[model samples]
Target: MIAYSRSIRGIERTEAYARTHPVNRYAAYPLTAFEQTPIAGTQGNRKKKEEAASQGVYSWLREAGQGQKLLGELLEKLGRHNGVASKEQLENSVHTLVDAMNRWESAYQSREQLLRPEIWEAMTLAMRHPAMELLGIKRGGQEVGRRLVWDPAILPQNPNMEEVNTLRRVLLGSEGLLMDLKRALSYAEQYTPMQLLRQPFIHMYPYVLYYGAAQAYHPLPPRGLIMNKTV
Candidate 1:
């Protein structure tokens, strides 16, 4: 009886160990290839890909799906909120947009782009969905503005009636000023997980069958872009 009990205990231990064992589960969120490396003891900013990937590990533990879904939904809502651009400005609109988008895109792609409180605010306005539908698609192939992450699937977050009404106009104006949506799309296509979410098992049969096993990453959004860093 004692031997029998000991055997049962060993079996339980093995099972428990298996359940608790670490596994390579990317189901939680998308990670760039650079983000796959392990973290260090310090939160050093020099090597960003490492920092983001490490931070990603912690972020997964605290409400993963809801926040990501919320972000997508909010983006979609913003899309619904954006007012149509009238093509009124003619020349000035394109010039103004190109300058601003270029500056922001440059900063975002650079290693120097640090997260400031003000940046969070800018992202709020910049991440609106209409930017994708209008600016991103129209100017996608330019240099790299807001095109990459502009999927129709990403839903918008719920906002007040008044805010929602104003959203479209605001986004259209912003979109008009930019050029280079393609650059952003290229990055997302190369790295982001959001790209993966839009297709295959989730998208439809033929579409999934088309890509087959050639898994790909989602493109990053134009305005609020995130990149992978090496630690």
Candidate 2:
């Protein structure tokens, strides 16, 4: 299983800290942003699980199709959107949609930031293997020349709490994620991205496409995340 790190100071503890210090705003925007977003119903969660399971078979075409469908729906809705209604009704409807999108975006971004420690830990685990020096996505706090496409150097070095948060923002943003994913998929290997999708770690899921391509060759890649040897 892809072991994700549990929070030492969970949301409740952070809330308590915030409550204790009234004036001290928790500037960790990603950490404390959407504590109240509603989780999806079982059906929705199951659908995600099913989709992921389908992707685990190295079917990039199918996975891309699903993503395209979702994006198409979102765009179709946006294209047809018209807020015309009774003043209060229009306000309420628009507000609801805006709020939903905001919550989703915030929550999605938080996954990476919240799980930064686990990502680092996973990288540490990956580094222990000698092959890491060659197969690793990063090294010496920078992108290795082995995969000379997208620069993982865009990420932080020996990421501290603050730097980790920034790295998450850079990597987890919709555009950034897609860009790196394209680079990873540049090679023509089917199972390259599959292994990444199958990881039990939540944070590592997004990275499957990015690192999967780099480690697509024989001797196979490690199950854990690759690191830059920062630690």
Candidate 3:
């Protein structure tokens, strides 16, 4: 009985080791060209590649900043919750965001120009889903997806509690979206694009899939949580 238990433990340990270090399973085979490269040389090459990729993203981001600014302003206006703005104001904001998206797409077709091939391919695939849409661009005289729109009926002065709650929910959702966007932009600015690739897998949202991964390393708690910590 003791011998059987020991054998089982050894087998389990060996399996776990194999799972964590997959390359060890192929130790009997001769090293490939890539495997034969010196560790330092490989790392240096990776670093350079990452730096170049990050620079591409950085330049694209600078141009995308205009869209981000517009979104931020809209978020701020909604946050105030005084009352719904005129239809013209809301339409203007939407049009501006749409134009920004079109400009960004035209300036650098992300599928062709951004990030490493695999990264961009994955992003393109992910962005095609309907749920993944946010301020989608106009492509070839057609709209790809619709941007977020606030409920015009919701207002602080409204007597209906349900409507007020609905507005709160919308604002909260919008805040979350804006926060993720800002987080991604900030991360790309501070660290290499490779760092983003290393971040833990989260959602497929552009913000989360790209720059938002950095949020795992530098977390910013909510305002209420921060206040609680101070107390």
Candidate 4:
């Protein structure tokens, strides 16, 4: 009976060890090829590639700083509630956020200003998603490029082009901004998760997906404007 109990405990310990093991996770988030190699200036051509890769890393770090700051602000707001939130106060708070969104979205359309905060917040949320494991898509050559790790299934199959177009219009259209704002506020009230901040891999996926999607979809800003790191 003692031997039988000891065997069961050994199995349990093995299982527990497997559950916390990071090998699988590290496999999922493999380091970039550039990260794998030492920068050798002997060849000279590789030096330029290394420099560009380092710049990309710095840009991602900056964006991460912005995301961390935004998340801290959100957490502070959540902490103040103390399990009691007044409807009027919540409405006013949401209104303020929506108003800011309005200004940024408008500026983006006109190419007058582009705001990175929304992108930062989106990155934060994507990284905190429970399934976040990988950070980048495999690219040819030595440099690694980040990619969003969402399942393609997250987007509906045969998504209605008309409805999708309408949604995009609602989000980007000035005339429809107020309606979209109201809907977003309502959704946030019901579904926003505050506990994501406590997750183990909260910081990893955001840097991957945010810059990955940006590089993939929007490689450059609007015509006639250079890159604006400030906005």
lDDT of each: 0.37, 0.36, 0.45, 0.36
Write out the backbone clash pairs for model 2.
none
Could you say which candidate leads in TM-score?
3
Model 4, 1-231: lDDT tens per residue?
Answer: 988887763335656666554666335445445434453453565467446544543444443344334434433453353201333433343344333443433333332122223433442333342222211111124331232222323333343656445433432244333333333323322322231112224336545556776879855333212112111
Which is better, 3 or 4, measured by lDDT?
A: 3
RMSD of each candidate relative to the true structure: 20.7, 30.2, 19.2, 25.8
Per-residue CA lDDT of model 2 for 51-109, tens digit only, reads 75554334433433443344344334333323121233323333443333233233323
> Which tens-of-lDDT digit does each residue in 1-231 have in candidate 3?
988877763335656655544455635445545444444455676578667666766665575466557667866765565332333443454455445445554545542344433433332343343322322322332254443233323223333656444443443354343444434334334445554343322223344433554656755333233222221
Write one digit per residue (lDDT tens) for candidate 1, span 112-208.
2322223223433444445444343233554654533322222233445654445344442334212123223222223344222212233254345
2 or 4, greater by TM-score: 4
Q: TM-score-based ranking, best first?
A: 3, 4, 1, 2
Which parts of model 4 are misplaced by more than 4 Å? Answer: 1-44, 82-231
* Clashes, model 3: 0
Q: Is candidate 1 or candidate 3 better by lDDT?
A: 3
TM-score for each model: 0.22, 0.19, 0.37, 0.24
